[model samples]
Target: MTALSEYERLEAEGIWRPDPEAQRQEVILSLGDATLVIADDRSATALAHWSLPAMIRLNPGARPAIYAPSAEPGEELEIADETMIAAIEKVHAMIEARRPHPGRLRGALIGGGVLLLGAVVLFWLPGALVDHAARIAPQAKRVEIGRKLLTEFTKMTGQPCHSPAGDKALAALAERLPGQQVIEVLPEALDGARLLPGGLAIVGRNTIAGPDTPEVVAGFLIAAQRGAAGERPLHRMLDWLGPAAALRLLTTGDLPDDGIAEYAQELVQHPPERPNNDTLLHAFREAGVSSTPYAYALDPTGESVLGLIEADPFKGQPAPHPVLEDAQWVALQDICSAH
Candidate 1:
């Protein structure tokens, strides 16, 4: 369903052959809730609707891929557009992944029987379920959950800060961190950076305000990445919501809106988690950023963060890459000014 939402209202043109003997004809194809609709080009009338889950692709890797409703003899559709082909493949993959796998169920049943023999099953089942759900969740589902949580977060923190120049600067910063999707700056309500589901990272205005260098901001980003890698955001949510919620998510690729809203409130009230010194140092070193600025910002006297200061990666030498140019840094600093 999340995959459908991502590719909703997508339409493309393709050549359709009604049968083996018929000539190919142009048709407009559109994606439905759970079907692929073929429409007549001129009249815009539906010609055929194929169940997406039941659709079959004939050509595995050839261009201008051919498809039929199923293995049965039927009309064939030939599509050459890469976007449409990718969309269909993605939707089918999501559907296939959601189906119950006999092998997996059999393994689980065997494991359950073994656990039943033990006295500590109750204490262990919940954690096992949460871990299983987190491990199996697809990237698309994680993105959907993150987007929903961000919407709820906005109710308390207000919309994310945005300015033309600031947005460009943020994009440039994101480019430095491989696999990072988006960096959101909240004008208020956040103390520092927190990683959401997917690759989203949220930070507070304090991260960029008052004598803060781009290195400090980069440090926060690195810390967020490390935290997310250590514990997946989905795992955190499932642990908070309990076993029933995790089971529901496994069956249906969604969580209750009310539960997510409650979690958002809880997140806004607490300080974001921090990674250990070793993890933080590793991230900073890999990113080619100095940790001294961020360490000093955490503790002005540098008493508590002495490790970070003493072990700064680029302490005496210059950074291999600049976090941001002077102009971009100026724009990033003023991201929350209008808000």
Candidate 2:
């Protein structure tokens, strides 16, 4: 009963010492059932039975390794055999695996409870339950989902533009923005801005770089914050994917590629409709941003978006602060080129 069947015949030579005062002697070394057997080389008489699990190498990673039966004061052996040292380490690892895992049983019970609860909820109200799951999903989970969606969207959108300096600059802007959104720039794949789950927004490269001022881009972002009377993108995604996708996300913390593929395609193909003017103005006012720049950006003449131009929120007085510094805007605009 050796540590392993393959190592049953493994043997090596080593020098052994019976105790601190005993003279060193050459010995025959061999592996036994969970033990290291030391024998008198001349007589072949077993002299020691060192428990493999209790063995400790005093000099690790050096030639002629020194080993003691345990940490306590005891006899020691010096073996330059790499094979035996590896086998001993493997036996220790096996013993470690057999040790009790703290809280494993408790964790399993909690996970089972969660799965059972999710199942019961799905059985009752499929649609409503899915909506609730998406709405209440933790921010970290939503961020995970949103990042995955962006990766998938790249199949059609190509890669989103990113560079070290640009990403740092964009992150700074995101911190100051209303939703603290992760905004990505996609070249030509999108003509307008669209929101994803979590606080992620994707806008066309042209939309971000072409605008004369960051306020125009900021308007597009604030409008995407609340779509068509406050129905967020999370709800829209669940509705499109149906209850099955939502339930899967809640239970498994992920969605299959097939489940989200079609929606990702649809999202890239059809950009979100323009946010209502009243809602847009309200968002602008709340975000401490101007709407006229956005209106003029939308219609250079400001004829079609005259209502937004007239009802501009930051019109009467100066803004508390600009949307972004001149340098930050330049860095963000340079993302596509740098990438």
In the order shown, what is each candidate's alpha-carbon RMSD? 28.9, 22.5
153-189: candidate 2 lDDT, tens digit per residue: 8888789899887787778767767676788888767
Cα-lDDT of candidate 2: 0.82
C-alpha positional error of residue 181 in candidate 1 after TM-score superposition, expressed in Å:
0.8
- Among the numbered candidates, top TM-score falls to 1
Best by lDDT: 1
TM value for model 2 = 0.60
Per-residue alpha-carbon lDDT of candidate 1 for residues 294-334, written as tens digits (9 for 90 to 100): 89878899999999999998999879999999899999998
Show model 2 residue runs off by greater than 4 Å: 1-124
Assess every candidate by TM-score.
0.63, 0.60
For candidate 2, the clash count comes to 0
Off by over 4 Å in 1: 1-121
